[model samples]
Target: MQYINFLPCEWNNDHGFTQEIFAIAIKNNIGIGNPDTVPYRKSQMKNSYQFLHKYKADINTITIAVQEPDYTYTNPKTSKKFTQAELYDFDKNYIGANIIFWNIQQPQFDSVLKFFANN
Candidate 1:
């Protein structure tokens, strides 16, 4: 099966937009209703930089990633053209953030990830 886009219907356009999204993370989650205000012991917090470095992963470390936008694709349903660029986001805290804003329309590189309404 082809990948289905989960973007909202209203977001359909010639190009896409950027926004903040919450991603699912697996870890221990102490109950919030615990009577104790400071419930379970506080686990050591690892900032974005710490997490990325722990896996020996960095944006610039990848060679097959998109570093420029040299092509564009059209939306089948809307016939609206959109730029096709592959990107992987790294935490801002990560010192080796090698983000490249391929398309000029895209805003300056940041920690947020961009997705198209039409996959």
Candidate 2:
């Protein structure tokens, strides 16, 4: 059987929901679903990747959903938004580290489930 780890941005606030989803996904052999609402600094993303790798999780099997440039913020000090180029650049740089990108605006849940089913 396959197992998928679903991580939500609000996991800290909704542990029960998180656990429920994780359990269901694991039992069904589906893909993990991670929210794109939370901002993940480059360092944090790298550290997370490292931690997962350390735990023997296949990097290729992991995917991170991210908001579109219009919805993503530039920084805490300013209300500026990130450009598409910047977002692509960040993903490109991190892609080699074994992270796949998914646009949250799309029907990611179904798409991910299908992806896992096919793979």
Off by over 4 Å in 1: 1-60, 63-69, 83-98, 101-119
Residue-level lDDT for 61 in candidate 2 = 44
Q: Against the true structure, what is every candidate's RMSD?
A: 18.8, 9.8
User: TM-score, each model?
Assistant: 0.17, 0.34
Ten contiguous residues minimizing lDDT sum, candidate 1: 30-39
Deviation (Å) of 54 in candidate 2? 8.5
What TM value does model 2 have?
0.34
- Model 2 agreement with the true structure over 27-110: per-residue lDDT tens digits: 555544333323345443433322333332433343444555424466443446653444444443433223445564554446
lDDT of each: 0.24, 0.42
Which pairs clash (backbone N, Cα, C closer than 3 Å) in model 2?
none
For residues 27-112, what per-residue lDDT tens digits would candidate 1 score against the true structure?
A: 22211110111101122112222222342231223111222232333334445533332223221222223332333344522312
lDDT of candidate model 2 versus the reference: 0.42
